[model samples]
Target: MSDFIPVNEPLLDGNEKKYLQECIDTGWISSEGPFVRQFEERFAGRVGRQQGVAVANGSGALDIAVHALRLGPGDEVILPAFTIISCAASVVRAGATPVLVDADPVTWNMSAEQVAARITERTKAIMVVHLYGLPVDVDPILELARKHDLRIIEDAAQMHGQACRGRSCGSFGDISTFSFYPNKHITTGEGGMVVCDDPDLAERCRGLRNLCFQAHKRFVHEELGWNYRMTNLQAALGLAQLERLDWFVARKRAMGRRYTELLGETAGIQTPLPRTGYAENIYWVYGVVLEDSVPFDAEEAMKRLAALGIGTRPFFWPMHQQPVFEKLGLFPAERYPVAERLARRGFYLPSGMALTEPDIEKVAKGVKEVLG
Candidate 1:
C-alpha cells in the first residue's frame, strides 16, 4: 500500500507562523487587526488595484461585488455556464438574471463571441471567470462591455498569478475577486478579497462587508449587508503566502510541465493546453478530459484512481444542469454542449505546490496504469 495523494495540498512554510504569532501576541485576531490591513494593501498593490476588501471566502466576495454594482430585478448578468455556481448564484441572489454562455472547447473558458450573442439591452454586467488554468479571452469581452456600457466582474479565483497579454487578470475587472482557499495558488485556510480601482466602489464593498454599519453610529444599519469580513489570523497567513506567490506559481508551472511530459503519450485523454494567444496555462489544476473513445467517465476514472491510492476531483458541473437552479426555474432547457461534455469527462490530478517530483511520477504512473 502507498500513500494516498490528495488533489491539493497547500504549502505554508513561509512567514505564516511568525505573523500568526504576532497576531496572537498582540491580541488582534479580529478583522480590525493590522495584518488584515497589510494583507489588503499588499494584495491590492500586487494586482495593480487601488483598494482591496478582504472577505470571509470567494463566494462572499462575489456576493458583495454583485451587490455593490447595485443590480436587481430587470438586470441581467452574463456569465459562463461552465464556472463555479457561486458566479451565477451571486447574481441570482441579488435578484438579477444570470445569462449563461457556453465555454470554448479548447480553453474551457467562456467564449467572448457567445457572450456577445447572449447580451440583451437589459444586460448590466459580464461576470468573467478565468477557468481551470487559462484566462478567458478578455479583450473582446472588454470591448463588448464598453460598447454595451456593461460592468465587468472578473473572477480571478483560479488566476492568482496569471496574466492576459501584458496585464494582470485581476486588474481588468471593475470589481475583481480572488479566493485564498487551501487549493488555490495562495492559502489562508479560507479567505477571499475584492479589489477595485474606484474609491467609491471600494468604500461600498467595505461597508457591505461589515453589515453596512455606520462609521459615526456603530451597530446601526441602514442598507442590508453581510458580515463577510476576514479575520486577522487568515490575513496573517495570506500575507505570508503572498510573499511566496511568484515562487508558488513557478513551482506549479514546473509541476504542470512535468506532468505534461510524463503523460503526453497517454491514450484516451486530452491534457490542458500549455499556451493560448493571450496567456500561458498556469495549470491551477492539471486537468485531463477523457476522450470519446474512453470507456469510462470522469467518475469511474476517479474511482479507479482512488482504488490505486490517487485522489482526484471532478470538474465543475455546469450551472445550467444544476438541480438547485433547475428547481428555481433558472436555465430551463438550456443546453451548452461544450460545458456539458467537459463536466462529464474532466477531472484533475494532484498538482499542488507541495507535490514532489516523486509524487508527480507516482500519480502519472497511477493514471497511466488505470487508463491503460
Candidate 2:
C-alpha cells in the first residue's frame, strides 16, 4: 500500500515563518499591519486590478460585493447551479433571488447562452464562477451583461491566475472575489480578497468588512455591517504564498497536462477542456467526468479510490438540489438537468501541489482498475 494521497494540500515556502515572526514581534498580528497592506497591493497588482480588499474568507468577500451592489428584494441574480453554495447564498443574503442557470459541460462554468436565456426584467446581475481554475468564457458573458445592463460579479475562488484572452479573470467584472483557503491555489490558512476597478465599490467593501463606520471615527455606524476583516497573520501567510504564485500555477498546469495525457485514453472518462485564448489555468482540482456507460457512479468510484489509498471528491451537488434552496422554493430539482447529471457523475482526482508524478500515476491506475 502506498501513502494516502489527498485531493488538495497547501504548499508553504518563502518568508512565511520570518514574516509571521516579524508580525508577532511588531505586535501587529491582527488586521492592522504592514503585511496586510503589502499583500493587498501585491495581490491586486498580480490580478491586474487597481484595488483589493482582504476579507476573512471567500464567502465574506462575496457578501461584501453583494452588499455593495445593493441587491434587494425582487432582484434576480443569474448564476450557475454547479458551484459551491456560497455563490448563491451571497445573493440570497443580499435579499435577492438567485436564478439558477446550467453550466457548460466542458468548462463546468455558467454558460453565457443559458444566462441570456434566464434573463428577465427582474434580472439585476450575473455572478460568473471560474470553476475548477478554468476561466469562464467571459467575452460573451460580458457582452450579455452590457447589453442587458446587468452588473457582473465574478466568483474567482478557484481560479487564482487564470486569464481569458489577454485579460485576467478578476479584472473583467464589476467586483471579483477570491479565496485563500488551505486547498486553494494559494493559502493564507483562511482568507479572501475582493478586487474591483471601481473605487466606490472598493471603499464600500472596506467599510462593510468592518462595521460600516463613517471612517472619520469608530463607534459610528453608518450602516449595518459584519466583522469580515482578514487578520495580519493570514495576510503574512498570503504574502509569502503570493511570492511563488506564478511558479505554483505553472507547476499546477504541468500536472494537469500530465494527468490529461495519462487519462485521455481511458475509455469512459471525459477530461475538462481548457478554453481557447486562456493564458493560464491554476487547476485547483483536476475534474473528470465519468460517462454514463461507466461501471460505477461517482460515489462508488470514490470508494474504490479510497480503498486503493487514493483520495477523491465528488463535484458540487448543484445548488438547486440542496435542501436549503429547495425549501426556499427558489429552483426546483429538475430545473438544471446538466448540472444534476454532472453532480452525479463527475469526480476529481488527487492533484495537489505536493503530488509527484508517481502519485498521479497511482491515482490513474486506481481509476483504471475500478472503471475499466
Top candidate when judged by lDDT against the true structure: 1
Instruction: Show the lowest summed lDDT stretch of 10 residues, model 1.
Output: 1-10
What's the number of clashes in each of the models?
A: 0, 0
- Candidate of highest TM-score: 1
Q: How close to the true structure is residue 95 of candidate 2, measured as C-alpha lDDT?
A: 88
Which clashing pairs does model 2 show? Answer: none
lDDT of 1 at 222: 88
Q: What's the residue-level lDDT of 16 in candidate 2?
A: 93
Model 1, total clashes: 0
Q: Please give, for residues 1-372, the per-residue lDDT of candidate 2 as tens digits.
A: 448999887678688999999998999998998888899999999999999999999999999999999987999999888999999999998889999888877777777888889999999999988888677888999999999899999988888877888787788879999999987878898899999988888998999998887757788786898899999999999999898988888888888888888888899988867445654556778999999898678998899889999999999999989999878887764578888889999989987788898888988888889886
- Alpha carbon lDDT of residue 288, candidate 1? 96
The per-residue C-alpha lDDT of model 1 at residue 284 equals: 97
- Those runs of model 1 whose alpha carbons end farther than 4 Å from true positions after fitting are none
Q: Over 4 Å off in model 2, which ranges?
A: 274-280
